[model samples]
Target: MAGLGGTKMKNTWQQVKKVGIVHRLLSFWSRDWFLKVVSIWLAIVLWVLVGGEDTIEKTVNVPVEIINLPRGLVVSNQYKKKIEVSLTGPRSVILDMDDRNIVRQVDLSKATPGTMVVNNDVDHIDVPRSLTVQRVQPPSIILSIDKLVQKQYAVVANTVGDVAPGFEVKSIRMNPEYVMITGPGSVLSQLSALQTSYISLDGFRRSEQLQVPLDLSPAIVSLIGETSVTADIVVGLVVAVKTVELPLVVQEKGLSLLPKTVSVTASFPQILLDKGKKAKDLLVAHAERYGQTDQFNVIVTSQNNEEFPVKVISVLPRRVSEGKAKLLRATTKKKSE
Candidate 1:
């Protein structure tokens, strides 16, 4: 009996061991394991078919970058800003590259003051390790370098629009009439002077003083002195000239004038003329009250108000005939004396 029981226990243990062996074998062929093997094999096959020792050419635009420029020097000419690069490299690497990955570098550290021609090649360009440079559309570029220079230029004031009706511009004064500027010699040599921004004088009636900035280019030129200037504008009163006719008045009784009117020229403030005041309203003529003869001198005066001062320029007739001129008849009855 004991032997039979031991045999039964041994068979059971053997059966359990066989089950464990089967489980171990099944673990190697599970769903996750099968997927991993398939993915690796597919990746290898695809690599061999698509990117194995194969090269392709592609054209891309790369920006030109300048570096290592010497101090106090500038490039005066605008050359090719971008270049087309034809690259021959592995298909896998070329397909992955975008416009940001490639760039052409230009070294101007040793440049001098002259026209220089630089060649484009792989040595100066930055690219991926797997890609090779085949050709460049513009194989060379020309640049002009110049020394920096500075000079003083006169500043002119510019004004736009007109002043008030009764006022005129007396004078325009700029505090600093000149400005010092620094820039490339090629551009600075051609510049003569600078101008201020347009100053609007529209509806200006009084003297004005303001600070105005100068108009200058920011890219290539720099101002060394004060960027702003003090503009002093003076406005003065305007005088208007006008002419009018006034009736000649006789003060003495029984006195009559031959010419009833005379032309009077005067200068007055422009403000008074624009206030609906006629030139004739400000003119008057007077005669002497004690004059015995009919002829008298017509004195012209301006009746202008206190606000408007009028200056009499001229009078058409200084003397007037009030029927006073008569030929004394010495009873010439054929001189019947």
Candidate 2:
């Protein structure tokens, strides 16, 4: 039983917006390059020292971008997403700055697949000499690197809360059934199947369709193509009904039943009715032993059947003639096994 359960960009890929590696790069530069170049150019020109201006300190957050990382390796640890730089510069120059285009670049040209720490310096910021670097919030970065690998794993739907009160999750279907991901091999090896983030079943009484992201650890892995999947969850009743024919017998007062078989219909808990369970395995029928003479009503119960409870909904041929064919007595012949 289960019950219910940011759009931001960083140094890591934006999951929802990233279509693929090639498409993302092309679209990013094409859409953003012109504005970025113009902003930097204007900021540089205007940054020339103003003779009599007062200097002030300002802090800005700059996005971090990783470059030149080898294709065979991936960073496995959480690194700085943004560098917070506090700069002291002329008031006029600082006010004219558009830091949106400013990015802190981290180069991995000489990097290998292992744990490493790198220092973040004030020089990484591209401000003119008029601005002096006062401080950087995080002076150093630590990262774990591992061999990059690709794998495909089956997808599972996840949910929280019980579906209504008398309902069950009959089945779960994923549109693509599986997911392919590119990530660090050490982390990928620990996973067998990818699971979607939890969806709510709180008071939900019927099937529904949902779009959910995979439950993945940050910085350790990245989805290859589709970032989220379509999930179809089926809900159904908790009880099941079945009809079966079983031999009816009499065990008390030395009496017998004439038509010694019956068609019995029963309702059973769906939780206990898997492939190995059957009507005969959970029900027994016999002629009633009480409250009648020469004629008895058929009694059905699941008494000796694994202590599981069953309800008799309908029993065809509800009564039988006793001691005759006309009321012919049922007989048992003893023999050697």
Candidate 3:
């Protein structure tokens, strides 16, 4: 029995030893160079799937030199003369660059009096290892400068308001219409003709007094600190007056009229009656001759009485040859009230 027990234990020990040997052989195969290389390649593929390349866009202000500036040309208000630029590329490259590495410039030497065209030559930007220039904000610019001759005109004051009803404007008066202005000879020659201050009252109702500021069209620097003309406008309302004419006619009611010539007469206020008295003054009038007549009456009506007081006065030629009398002349009375 003891011998059999020892045989059984030996067989178990042999099986355990075979298992250990198999494990050692598997470990050796796993540590092989070719297998180790394959595992590293798989790890790299997984890393690429999880992490991607970084791309970013950035904006920067690039400094530039203006070449070929024209003689006698001066640039005013050139504080922000740098060009605005935008760049896009790999994140690493863009983050490594600074604004000083970029260059911007405008050539004024070849410029003219008018708008000078700016060139879009942007080859001066020193980009980082991986970044490149994308675009510039203002591709070009026009440098406006003072020419030889320049002229300035005074600014006029325009009113806008409403006045009381039943009144009209009598007259409008302005203090000064023009001012003296001198600048570059070239600019002055172009501005040979000057315009007086123009007052515009598009929708004015009430009386108004305003001190308006003057503005120069196409603002020029030469007119700075120059003397400007001041103006005062007077607006008033007056009564409205109207003129009318009555024709000379003959009419009679209870008289057996005979054949005879008749005359006519008219009367009115000096201002109303005096207007167009002669052919030169008479804007329009009409009269017809008739025989002897009776029953004569002159009729008059008011046209516009809002401002001026108006009324009929007297008439001439009270009777005619026929039963009807001819209307000679009629008159109207006018007062300021």
Model 2 lDDT per residue over 1-337, tens place: 1222122334235554465766878877898798988998877766654555688988888788888898798887767799888888889778766734777788888899888887888888777777788888799888887898989999888888888765688888997897777778888898898788888888877789888887766543443543688989898657788888978877766655667689988877665675456657778888874465666778887853443467889998888766553324222332321
lDDT of 3 by residue, 91-139 (tens): 6566766633556755566665655456544455556646667887677
* Candidates ranked by lDDT: 1, 2, 3
- Badly placed stretches (over 4 Å) of model 1 are 1-50, 53-56, 99-101, 160-166, 173-179, 197-232, 239-337
What's model 2's overall lDDT? 0.75
Instruction: Name the top TM-score candidate.
Output: 1
**Top-down TM-score ranking:** 1, 2, 3
Superior candidate under lDDT, 2 versus 3: 2
Candidate 2: list runs displaced more than 4 Å: 1-49, 157-173, 196-337
For all candidates in order, the CA lDDT equals 0.79, 0.75, 0.49
Worst 10 residues of 2 by lDDT: 1-10
Runs off by more than 4 Å, candidate 3: 1-56, 61-84, 88-103, 124-134, 137-148, 157-208, 213-231, 236-337
lDDT of 1 by residue, 46-82 (tens): 8896678689899888988989999999887878899
**TM-score to native of every candidate shown:** 0.50, 0.47, 0.34
For candidate 3, the per-residue lDDT at 10 reads: 100
Clashes of each: 1, 9, 53
